[model samples]
Target: MRVPIYQVDAFTKRRFAGNPAAVVVLPSFPSDTVMRAVAAENNLAETAFLVQEEGQYHLRWFTPAVEVPLCGHATLATAAVVMERLSPNLGGVVFQTASGELPVARSADGYVLDFPSRPSEKVSSPPDVSKALGIMPTEVYRNQFNYLAVLDDARNVRDLQPDLVAIAGLDRSGIIVTAPGDDGYDFVSRYFAPAKGVPEDPVTGAAHCMLAPYWAERSGRSSFVAYQASRRGGEVVCRLCGDRVELEGSCVFYLEGQADISL
Candidate 1:
């Protein structure tokens, strides 16, 4: 079988700067095992697979090791592929996913992802959490998806070098370390999900689902511009609505190729 694949860098205008995701547009759904094998072979933070059904797309995301319910960067990259290649005249696309229906629209700035807001509740930091992170956060919060660690400074977020093994031991899907931005941006963050096979994500849109609400209450603002302080950094624009969050960012196309796999 021959599968068309595109590698796109999400949340950045330039290549090799943001989180790269592999997007495969399928004529029909493949078996879970084949999809998992393809994702493992891609070996990026996330690989997105989509199939059109009844005029809408059904999307799924996979890491090298596991399939996740939701993924922001990969979703953004998928939207780009749908808009640019699949349907150039399309102003927007609605995707049915494990997390639910996600919609992406083209905007003047870039692409806007309409995602559910994930507000976190205050919680005590787990002892191992600090040990894994190598530094204690000022406060801790938990949502359905990840643990949000509020640090004192953005520099701390940028400079962190966590023990991946220890992080893998923590009982959470992922960990998000964040702080107030120093520059024009509102906040900054870094994500670690060793358990899910992503040691660190360069630019995470899913983390912002929690961060948007967290910062909105703290900063008393509904809109924000955020920066992910990874080695290959990128930018995210966020806005918190009552029950949803709007994330905006651009994508850079890196490569397009065919993957040959035996059926």
Candidate 2:
């Protein structure tokens, strides 16, 4: 079957600037092997699968190498697809995902994704983590993604050049280096997941699930701006509301294609 595919640049208003996510909206669930092959064929960071069921959309994320449990940018990109294509008047979209029920609403500013509060617990980063990076963070914490390294400044986050081989040896999801943003934005961050085949993600939305709340408290602003200082940079509008976080960003449709895959 020729599955309709969409390529979107998430977290940025400009085309070809933000993290790109390939979206495949299938009439029904496709075979695992077929989906993986489709994702691999796309060769993007994450390919989102969307299917409608019981009045809600079922969403799944797949990296170029493997399927992931949760993904933020692609989710936002899916919301954009739904609004722009599936239902222009959806007003809001609900995604029943592995993480749980997630809602994306169209706000005056942009699309707001209400995600669960993923607060990283205060903990010590593994020594091997810093050893691998050749630098230590001022503070460390633990979350679903591994170590959250609080750097001295945004420049440090930008200056990180880790030994990918050593990073792959560590027992962690990935390392997040963050510091206050110099560009009008609240904070700047970069994600490294060599273990997962992505040496450095251009703009990691899931990592910021924790990052939004973490910086919100420190910056003492319920609403703040953020920038992912990756080579293919992106920007995000974040809001902290109690234990939940609202991550907002724009998505640009880059291309449309077809994936012919059969089980």
Candidate 3:
């Protein structure tokens, strides 16, 4: 069998500067084993599979090692594919995912992703966390998905060189280190998730679900511009609206091809 595939760099207007996700638009849902194999073969942070159902698209994201409940960059990349290639007439698209109904709409700047807000609670930092990260966070918070670590400076967040082996042994999904941004950006963050097969992510959308609310309370603002200071940097426009967070970023196509694999 043959499967169509697309590689898209999300959260950046230019290629190779953002998180790249593999998108496969399928006529029907493939078996879990097959999807996992495809994702492993692609070896990207996330592989998004789309199947149109009842005029909406059902989307699933897989890492090389496991399936994740939520992913931001992949969803944005999928929206770009739907808008520009799959359904050119669509100005927006609703994606049914494990997280719930996610809506993506085209905006003047790029595309806006409406995601549920994930507010974290202050918690004591784990000893292993500090040992792994090499620096103790100013504050630590925990949510259902991951841990949020706050630092005093954006440089601290960017300069971190974590022990990936120790991080992979942590109990949670991952750790997000963030601090106030400079040079016009409101906040800056870096994500590490060795457990999920991503040692470090270039730009993470889902992490901002927690970040937007946290910063809103601290800075007393509802809108923000965020930067993820990874080797390949990317930016995100964030907005907090009650229980929801809006993440906006641009996507660029990297490659379009077919995967020749038999089911």
Candidate 4:
């Protein structure tokens, strides 16, 4: 079988700057083993698979190591592929995913994603957090999926060199380091999920689900321009609305091809 595949750089207008995710448009859902093997073979941070059902889509995301419940950048990448390449006239799409129903709408420039808000609760720092990140965070918070480490400044967040092994050993699947941003951005962050096969994510959209609510509470504002400070940095516009977070970003298509697989 020849499966259609596309690679897109999410959260960036230019190529190679954002997180690249491979999107496979499949006629039907494949086996878990097959999907996992495809993700491993692609070797990207995440691979998104989509199957049309009842005029909507069922989406699943996988890291090279494991399947994740939620992934923002890959979701955005899948939206791009569906709207731009597959159906140009389509204005929006809803994806039924492990996280829930995710809606993507087209904007003048790119797309806006309506994602579930993930509010983290403040907590005492874990013993290994400082050792893992090599710097003590001013505060720590925990949610169901990740640990949020608040730093004093963006420089510390940008310059951090963490012990990936220690990070992997943390209780949470991922750790997000964040601080106030300069250069007109509201906040800057970096994400590490070594246990999930992503040592450092370039531009994480899912991380901002926790970030938007936290920053809104801190600054008394509900909207923000966030930057993920990685080697290939990307920007995201976020807003908190009740129980949902609106994330906006653009995508750049990099590769389009077919994956030949034996059924």
Candidate 5:
């Protein structure tokens, strides 16, 4: 069958400035192997697939190597695909996912995603961790994903050369290093998920689940803007609540095509 697919640049208006996600709004979910092959072929960090069911959509995310429980930018891309291509006339949509239920609403400004706020716990930085990162961080912590490194400044967040092979061996999924921004943004971050096959995620909304709250308390700012320092930068607006976090960003559809596969 010929399946329709879309390539969206999440968190940026420009085509190549943000994280590229392959969104496939399929009539039905494909097989696990097929989905993995599609993601590998697309060669992006995440590929999102969705099918409507019971007034909500069943959404699944696949990396080239594995399927993740949740993915923020790809979720945003799925919402954009639903708003513009899947069901263009619909007001909004909800996704039933492995991470429970996720909702997406269409706003005049942009899309807002309500996700669980994962507060990190402060911990001593392992000497090897800093050596693997090639920079010494001011502080280190463990979030749900992996180590969270608070650098001296945003410049440090961008300047370090990560030892990806060594990082992959550390444990957990990956690491996120961040610091306060110097310019317009409130904070800057870079994600390294070698276990997930992503050395440096261009824009990681998922990482900010921990970053937003950590910096919010430190900076005395409840709401803040974050930027990923990857070469293709992406923007994120985040709000830290008691136990919930909200992320807002825009997604631009770069291309729409068809996937030919034998079933």
Candidate 6:
């Protein structure tokens, strides 16, 4: 079987600057083992698979290590592929996913993604996590998928050098470390998911789902301009609306090819 595949750099206007996700558009859903193997071979932060069903699309995300319930960058990349490549006439696309229905639409600012807001609950700092991160955060919070670590300075978040092995031992899928931005950005963050085969993600849109609400409650504001402080940095525009969050960013197409897999 030959499947069309694309590589797009999400949350950045330029190639190789943001997180690169492989999008495989298939005629039908393949075996879970095949999807997992493809993701492992791609070896990016995430690989998104799409299958058009009825009138909408069904999407799933896989890391090299495991499948995740929600992934914002991959979803953004998938939307771009569907609207820009597969079907240019489409102005938007709705994806039925593990996290429920996710909608992405084209706008003047780029592709805007509507995602559920994940507000984290305060929790006592885990000593192991603090040790693994090598810097203690002022506060710690946890949602369903990840741990949110709040630091006092952006420099702390940027300069962090954590132990991946120790982080992989944690219970959650990943950890997000964030602080107030120094430049025009409203906030800066870095994500580590050694347990999920992503030691450090370049630009994580999903992390902002939690960060937006956390900062909103503290600053009494509802909108933000966030920058993911990874080696290949990227920008994310965020807004909190009731129970959902809006994340806006652009994508750069990198590679387009076919994956030949024999069954």
Clashing pairs in 3: none
Instruction: Itemize residue pairs with steric clashes in candidate 4.
Output: none
Instruction: Report the lDDT tens digits of candidate 1 across residue range 44-85.
Output: 999999899888899999999999999999999999999998
**lDDT by residue for model 2 over 80-145, one digit each (tens)?**
999988899888989999889999999775588988777888777678878877788888877766
Rank ordering of all candidates by lDDT, starting from the highest: 4, 3, 6, 1, 5, 2
List residue ranges in candidate 3 displaced over 4 A: none
lDDT per residue (tens digit) for residues 1-263 in model 5:
78888999998978888999998877788799998888888899999988876677899999888999889999999999988876889777788999878888887767988888889899888887898899888999896677898897888888878999988898668889898887898989999987887878889878888888898779888899889999999999899878878889999889899987544
Estimate the TM-score for candidate 5. Answer: 0.96
Using all chains and alpha carbons, the TM-scores for the candidates as numbered come to 0.98, 0.95, 0.98, 0.98, 0.96, 0.98
Report model 1's TM-score to 2 decimal places: 0.98
User: What TM-score does prediction 2 earn?
Assistant: 0.95
Local distance difference test, each candidate: 0.92, 0.85, 0.93, 0.95, 0.87, 0.93
Question: Per-residue lDDT of 105-220 in model 6, one digit per residue for the tens?
Answer: 99786799999999999999999879989989999999889999899999999899999899889888889999999788899999999989999999888899999999999999
| Candidate 2 runs further than 4 Å off | none
Predicted structure 4, TM vs. truth: 0.98
lDDT string, candidate 3, 154-228, tens digits: 889888999999988988889999999977899999999999999998899999999999999999999999999
For lDDT, the strongest prediction is 4
**Of models 3 and 5, which has the larger lDDT?**
3
Kindly provide the TM-score of model 3 when superposed on the true structure, using C-alpha atoms. Answer: 0.98
For candidate 3, the per-residue lDDT at 74 reads 99
Worst 10-residue lDDT window, candidate 5? 254-263
Q: All predictions: root-mean-square deviation over Cα?
A: 0.9, 1.5, 0.9, 0.8, 1.3, 0.9
Evaluate residue 9 in candidate 5 and report its C-alpha lDDT on the 0 to 100 scale: 93
Model 4 C-alpha lDDT per residue in residues 1-263, reported as the tens digit of each score: 79899999999999989999999999998888888889999999999999998788999999999999999999999999999998989999999998889999999889999999999999988879989999999999999999999999999999999999999999999999999997889999999999999999999999999999999999999999999999999999999999999999999999999997554
- How many residue pairs clash per model? 0, 0, 0, 0, 0, 0
